[model samples]
Target: MSLSSLRRQDAAVVRSSLALRPLALAVHMLAVGAAVTALPVYAAEPTEEAVTLDAVSITGEAEGGLSDVTEGTQSYTTRAAKTATPLKMSLRETPQSVTVVTQQRIQDQDLQTIADVVNNTVGVSLNRYETSRGQINARGFELNSLMIDGVPTIYEQPWSSGEIFGSLAMYDRVEVVRGANGLMTGAGDPSASLNMVRKRANSKELTGSVEVSAGTWDTYGTLGDLSMALNEEGTIRARLVGEYNDGDSWIDHHTNKRETFYGTMDIDLSEDTTLWFGASRQENNSDSPAWGGLPVWYSDGSETNWSRSTSMSTDWSKWDTTYESYFVNLEHTFANDWHAKLGYTRGERDGDSYLIYPFGSPDPVTGLMGGYGAGSYKTNTTQDDYYLQVDGPVELFGRSHDVAFGYTHSDQDFDADTRGYIPTANYDFNDFYDMPEPDWQPLTDSDASETTQKALYAATRINLADDLKVILGVRSTDYEKEQGNSKIKEDDEITPYAGIVYDLTENLSAYASYTDIFLPQSQHDINDNQLNPIVGESYETGLKAEFFDGRLNASAAVFRIKQDNLAESTGLFIPGKTPPTFAYEEGDGATSDGFELEINGELAPGWNLMAGYTQFDVEDADGEDVNTQYPTKMIRTFTTYRVPGFLGDKLTIGGGVNWQDSIYVYAANPSGVAEKVEQDAYALVNLMARYEITENLSAQLNANNVTDEKYMDFFEAYGAFTYGAPRSLTASAKYSF
Candidate 1:
């Protein structure tokens, strides 16, 4: 272990030097990445419930005079997406709170990943930890539903990015369903669902793009996407996307890297049907399996701000992970008013990493924070999953009604191993630090185990009238786990969902929705059996409007939610026969409420706006503050305008601003927490100007974090903290054909 630590420590020095590498070159490559086309013309362009038959076409993208409007209440698409946008419309006309982050906006703001995009959208809060290194939540709810081309892709928890990183490059536009989608989505805890629309083969010719980026912390990476027609008729389409990113964490000594490869094929199985077959693979590298996500402060019990730079593992800190997935989908349209679809997906994951954190130390003869005997969770994960769903339209009465119903299921599993080493187990605390990298000392024994889950769900949509619609759905899941124990930890649960949309006028509407999301507990009972899955429900209502025939849209909404089956983790409770351990007590809770308002669309001749406000409260079973870890009230906004360019509208300039109020951070437990730290509200500004040197070529510049405000981004219960990013700027030239 000592030898391993020395090598890693040496690597750290090299890494620190690497972080200082120039990023301007990387930015130049990225800014020109997507604009790879050359010289002819510089042109660019850019969720259902469990209900089976959804009929509402409530979106800002409906084109051709909104002639093909669905009977449903809301839906939106990009200028070139699932649906065409109406002619010359304003965003305020859409009857839903929508925020469209255009590619131009993405570039202007230097948005790096999908997370960056969502973080910019209104009413959307990204809650993630630099440590723990996993999971994205909205409205304090874990994101469970992900849609690719309208197909649901549920990411398994305790899972790695080997699966998610694939979607980042292939995505063309990202649409978010802010509330319950149980009608077709099945089960959700009432947070938000995201749909990643893929770049299609709609173009007549060939198109490709590649991007590279480098930023603070020596972060540099590349992504490539290429699309082509496989048939003379241009009916069959093929697309491939790949990526490679390697970088370090904000903290010292931590490292991360990932690579992705994906291929997708689309065939006109028939005029009325399209067939999709695709696969993706991702590889990940890291030293710590714990993902540095664990809190640094020990709830005021001990080790308060001890050392933020301490390595969690003494040895075996490097982790290697990989994931592969394949999927098949069919979309068929019949001569009748009926349409049906089916899809199946298979995914697999494997990982091996080391976990090292100071568990405890003995009394020091001299004294130091370090000690010998240490335990580590070093292991491999092997997971496989399968999912299936089918849906079509159904008519009930004479009144025109559209309906769709579908069922989905998946099986997931993982294994984690724990290892402990006491190379001088008898050494006194004083000598622990005296010995070089004592935590890296020799290993002793190791143990392993796994957890599995199975889920089933269905949903549908029903059109009530020319102005009203209803959506409903449900999902049932079973969670089972075994951790070196004979008894099995089993749990069965069901979540329900519903939504309604009412059109008051051709350009105005009202909508309401509810959904429940569920998840199995990560903590196990004394029996080593998994605990019951936690469940949450969300209820929401809102009003929306669309103008210029749905070219633009705006909306206001309010919601309330409740969560149950939460683990208290008292750190004070012990099972009857179980020895006193980490007190993770069990408890139930509910009652969280919030209101939101937002606007997204073309407001004027060439102006756009995306803004939102939210006030919320989350409590425990006793109706007390459980979500005090974060802020309760916040507002965000962004606006941009494409001025009638000079030299015949060829010279374009635009800019935007992002601002937020102070947020509350919890440094300790509710009882022992330090004084709440109030983060001063700050804003970041960005500007962009492009000159059409030729029809196909142009020069552009982008600046981000304009204010250079120094601030903290995230804070955890254990007092762990990370700082926000500093300012950055980039310039590039592009050619499109």
Candidate 2:
């Protein structure tokens, strides 16, 4: 909700970028400062050319929010690193719509939760609720890919409607790569990929900071981040972040509290090679977890579906979960301008949520008793992953080419169980009033179900000419699942990708890319016949440029995505041994095609900006032109301006607007007629000004939803809708040595 604080954070990055010497490390750090340091949202504007083409070594987005553009961006990047550290370059240097929510930004805005951070980020939507369970919607796709320090940490465990509630308190910055990333991702959903960078050793000597906050609903919390340099050479550094959050929501039947501890170490083995290691541990406990979405309307079965509010359940027990993860990565460079990077990680998640919802109990037609059925269920999840990558300048024929090649593999496992239950409801009660807390059924034993997957993939990038560059990639996955006494194994074929970029000027470039992904079947069909996974592909083209030695940047892009041979299951045969049966009913495919334009950069003095817009058109390959659930278009913009000299030297004022177009969901009919549920387009205006009380202390007032924009965040699965948030505000102060 706080936008101003974010702007000041950007000012801090600009300040840092300006102060750092032109050391490779300093350049790398400053260029990408916006992501990890929490820079203010007010980025500078795009000028003539962001980065000079001669210096356009990497396809640039590096023109960054602080940098300007000579050519359009081949991609749109969030913020650049503080310095021009090629090894640790900024996101702008990467040709993609990548955003970095830095640590400073995290503090300035008082963004205490992961959901809060995602909301402030461009091109992302929150589909998840509750502290223990979380979900995020991206470019009309559900996110299923995640990494910690460039290591795989995502699994099939998202039961509370998502994998787990992630906290932002321990992170340095969040990196998001929009669109299909299966080329480097190995095996997973192509929707998008997120890399949560943990706080690493930064203090040249010894430094630390602590933050505490209290908000509505008795919400209170504390956070601490510390760092130390073990040697004068500053080659060995260590950082630690810890947080404890305890609170209750407006819900009547739930209580919850959570804690986390994270530690990271970085050693500059040598100027050519650096090694890093990170670990994280988290714990959560909650009661009456909203098993699912609240009904759109209640009692009379009338849709109360109102805006500015949404709710889950009451009295969901212990609902506890534990997450433990560790990772190690190394990067090296050769005299021939070649570089190699390798990383490995292990992650594990265990938890359960208990709930029994209303099901098959009644028929108004017969009144013979069949309105709702009740049952208790629990789920268990686990995961393991490994990856290796290497890219360098290589020789092809007689041409000197910039080549990048890498490979990755992943293995994951998941299981669940359910038991019978009895409820006090034989009658229809949408209000959930006068409900009965009946006793449990003495079922004999708990039933179990399990699933697993293994994948391997490789990819490469080639620079064919000074004006033309290309990239290619491929991946394969082996998957399996077991239910009761039955098991099934399947294979997802090769996923490949290719791209090309053309430099129009010394500061401008145009590029195009094609990427693909293969997804596995959801559940088993009747006769337990196997169904192939869908092959999804994306086509994109855009422009890019960098400015101010990569201090500022800007980009614009357009794309088209399509999926073929989609598998639709049908309940064909009946009375089978496997119990539940499904059939693969081949149908028309689905395609999402759209155009996007983004402007990001820092203007002269102390101004910063980041904005993006997306428009989508999707339908079955048969061309029925169905009203898609995804927004037709979205645009979000934010900026900040620092005051001149005197008493105002340390003060900054900033704010921006975020808007989204209407969306449509299937109608109320059993057949689901396409009901164009129009979500009125609303712009969120935010304001904030920060003043440095001291070199180590600062205070900021952040206000969000300035206009009290009302809207729906999610609707589709079981019900019609859930509303978004209303005008809200928060304030905070921070101190750092």
Candidate 3:
């Protein structure tokens, strides 16, 4: 069957699914109601009692310390997090599945980029479309929300932007909350939210670290970090971080260079007030990068088996991009233990690229290929955002509860220009390495747009009893966008959130949550009118546990996500247009049902572990599978052990494996016959070893893809795919003062 036929069949399934939503929702609500009613039986009255215990004094532990920053913590888990809600709560209290990739984990796994982090994260997947661009997905939906210090930013699709290529040297940790996050993000997909916490100037004395490394394919890199108190009274502090990396790829003529710098300062305004500011810049340049990917089939109607090092790029092709950001925050604490914060951020992104895209397939025998297209493109984007939030404890029913209120406003502008050239003559596929550059035409305006968003949100965590707690929140958003002659605006869109957590025992708890988000669509219907925004609703229930004084965390969760008003193509094009546009219609949408199990933390005195398993199925109303390109089953795990008897407890060794089930896409072969292009299930093995040479110096080595597995990193319905990296190794040494 053709791709179009598959889509039509999926649409029919969607309609059928829609007809059953009312019944499904009714049943879900009834179940929640039954649980709420049964809570009284589990609640017990508190009684005063006296107990004797050993008294111990712990040194080097501060009161009300910074639990959000996991830089100095060697454990894989944290005591508490505020990513799911503004209020600080343990993982078991948030009523959502949360994962924190701490600094220790980043170093243990040698993760250098955000893409690397996501690929190793539980229940999350990274889809690499090209060398420098990719998408992040979870729960069978693309993730579009990114946050830094609780501030949100919307990134464009992977094909158009390089946002996912950001470096991780400036961040102390990454926090991910799976499911709908409309309360904090205001507008986005229901997949997941990723928040990166920046490292701060928290030291009172001079402290720093430096590291250098060299790896396979002539790759070398260096990193430096410094922090110190600038004032004699230790009231003002500053920190600086920088990194530089250059590497040659396994693919012929492909090379990458990256540079990053970040600086931050914190000033004490008074005994209860502080001002913080920071600036960061990152630049990435790639030479001879492929525009798309290699063809999946040859002209003879047989699958093509190109070498992993094959390339379809010319020597002159390059992609150069830069990201710069500035932010300021003021925070005040009251005598009542309440806090208020005001913040502002400005971000800018610039890109310049010259690329060539190969089309059609080559003859298997002669290696002759079809024509190619080339272009020179440039893009610039700028965003300014402001927000104010107040959060503290409130007295409700003679009990202390947490509540927060906030408002945010953002404005963004984008502009793009391109020059294009197409070659009519066919060339031999074997000659792609020496392909000639095309003479591009003069640059002209391609697209320009402006967007604005305003939102108001509030949340409150109410302590109903000693073992029961409930959280309720809501958000109202006003969004608008404008282009040359078109405008799309949505006002007063309301999103609601609710969750309940009940303690089952001292070490375990059970919870449930419901939330929703709205996404505006740019597609138009047959009437030439824009379609309604898509609405996503998510329901989840889970069990959570903490052991060894919160050193280890575990969670088991089940979730279902439903989307309404999804746009589907009508197989008809708008008439009288230079470039034809497809007409679409509103469909009932799709549903995803899944579950996740995760565990992270220290299992023993000198051992740390992080592991997770995820499985989900996505189907339309008619129960037909959709989004088949994304795997339905995945497992990610890593662990490290410090040998107490070996080298006087100075050596640590670790290893991990990441596995995903098979994925396939329907595409047309070179002979115009529809076929399934699939990638078999695969796993990548990684290993690491670190040795403490002295009290203040260490050496480490990391090996990735140890099995030398050959797999595709990305695949599309257009019969193009990108290959994953082969076995590689890196060794480094670091010194601290």
Best by TM-score: 3
Query: On residues 143-219, what C-alpha lDDT tens digit does candidate 3 reach at each position?
Result: 97788877785444222656777899998778899988888887788889898877777777899999999999999
* Candidate 1 TM-score over all chains jointly: 0.72
How close is every model to the real structure, measured as TM-score?
A: 0.72, 0.78, 0.90
Winner on TM-score (1 vs 2): 2
Alpha-carbon RMSD of each model: 12.0, 10.7, 7.0
Model 1, residue 475: distance off in Å is: 3.7
Give the clash total for candidate 2.
102
Off by over 4 Å in 3: 1-69, 157-159, 422-424, 524-529, 569-584
lDDT of 1 by residue, 554-621 (tens): 56666777777777664444455445554454577656666666655445445555566666655555
lDDT of each: 0.52, 0.56, 0.81
Tens digit of lDDT per residue, candidate 2, span 69-162? 2222312233343111112234333445556555445554566666666666666666542334556656655666666555556744445433
Query: How does model 2 score by TM-score?
Result: 0.78
What is the descending lDDT order? Answer: 3, 2, 1
Lowest-scoring 10 consecutive residues by lDDT in candidate 2?
A: 52-61
Candidates by TM-score, descending order: 3, 2, 1
Measure candidate 1: CA RMSD.
12.0
Write down the worst ten-residue block by lDDT for model 1.
49-58
